[model samples]
Target: MTLTQDAAAAEAAAHPRRESVYRPGHPVDIRRTVGMLRRGPGDPTMVFDGAVIWRTVRTSRGAATLALRAVGDEIRASAWGAGADEALETVPALCGAHDDPSGFDPSHHPLIAEVARRSPGIRLARTNEVFDALACAILEQKVTGLEAFRAWRLLVTKFGHRAPGPTPRPMYAAPTASEWHRIPSWDWHRAGVQPPQSKTIVRTAARADSLARAFRAATTGDDRDRVLTSLPGIGVWTSAETRLRALGDPDAVSVGDYHLAHEVGHALTGHRTDDDGMLELLAPWAGHRQRVIRLIFASGVSEPRRGPRLTPADHRRH
Candidate 1:
């Protein structure tokens, strides 16, 4: 089957593209902010080239290609495709304009305080697109970053709609929920996605519409987590990830992450800890736990690996 580049090209030709200039009061590092959305160095949905970023989104309106660049204190944004207008409208939030750090006092911990002082440009970005964030999170479940990123690259390149713009490189928007559901089992295998992860994606995609609405309507991060984890395959880690990415929930701490607890513990107390210990350690930050965790990651402090890196499982071989 041919790629959907033709359809997006035709649609772009028929519509007037949208553009906006967003002036975030603070020094906004566009790459550091939106780079959270990128799955890997070779992610098909996001490209960071120098000071500019090109991203393709499967928006509620439709597929869109957004180009964002930081100029002086203003962020210049341009969007192409049916969803261009919507994408342009959300540029400010996407650049972390809505992330308020007023209540986040870094004085609770010396390490956190130092990191916060040094990394003033770090802000939690919100996509406001639930399914895309959820799907990406699900793909990462129980897998190494290498495996997850490769699966994302292969799947999006093969099944996703071609991005509608002059991207730095060929890019594509993540497939819609229905399209994700329709991706064949063999295709998932070929992409190195395990059966469990692939099944979870398909099952979630089947109810993406209602789930998206539920997640959007939920007022608190806990409520959203309840709605997300109610699904059979989704758990605390996936829910927290989705909330962080989709809603920019400041307090969403990934409880079940394999290395997060150890990393947080090492960064905070100079040793390793379990998930429970991590929770207790992060409890001081409570409402801003994820922000603290982000600081820890940005601080370049991680637990030394006791052994060799875990070899990524190649499910295709099985």
Candidate 2:
């Protein structure tokens, strides 16, 4: 009943074919697929360290489970699922799977290069699961992260199925679109969701199937943005965030974040910047804005200002 055991069972059921491409004991890390099921606070998920081995991917085609272990200098991959072989073949594309240093030429930008060199573990976080990402984004609308996380935990526990695998920690499966729609208003209140956010979730859920199709069909930048923004409550920022994870976009700038401008400013110029300042600072790397931001984040240059932390407000107690 452990995550690893559950994963082993799922792998066995799927009958994965193995191939080696990475060396065992080498540094390997797979970004957890956002919204994939995991046990609660008490449980843990088992992941490979040293060498990048074993990743669970949910894609447009279906769930694509992969296991990678190190062998000499090469990394081997064992993948299985509805489209196992194709998914495995597409792993590199899905995972930015080319040589690590190919597109990210650090030499062009001294700051980026230094950051990348220093923190090589900051690979892009991919969720391959569009609906889950969208749902989570919806939950986060106009609320503190604590509120969102609390609601997410409650909703998932109430409606999400247990993730299949032997994960070391407990995690909840993100609720499916239909399941999200089925959540009663009272439950939303209990989960600490305000009426507005709750309505957005319901609205999105009703059109989930259509949105999923549109997301898959969207190939051009304009087309993708248009399709995502067509939904209620899915504006520029929300759509951008969802597309960033769902499509693994490298340049999606989070424009409306409360902290990003300050973080970017602190990292770039030792002062907090507004959205305009943040955009101006990032203009040099337009195509790779998010990547640069990631590097700045990895660099760990931002320090806390001498001020009180944002106080948490409990609407339930209000």
lDDT of 1: 0.89
Clashing pairs in 1: none
For every model shown, what is its TM-score relative to the native structure? 0.93, 0.75
Global CA lDDT computed for model 2: 0.64
* Residue-wise C-alpha lDDT for candidate 1, range 160-239, written one tens digit per residue: 98877778899999898899999999999999988899999999999999999999999888899899999999998999
Summarize candidate 2's per-residue lDDT along 262-304 as a digit string, tens digits. 9988877789999889889888766677777877866768858
Model 1 lowest lDDT segment of ten: 1-10
Give Cα-based local distance difference scores for all models: 0.89, 0.64
Give Cα distance to truth, residue 98, candidate 2, Å: 7.7
- Stretches > 4 Å off in candidate 1: 1-17
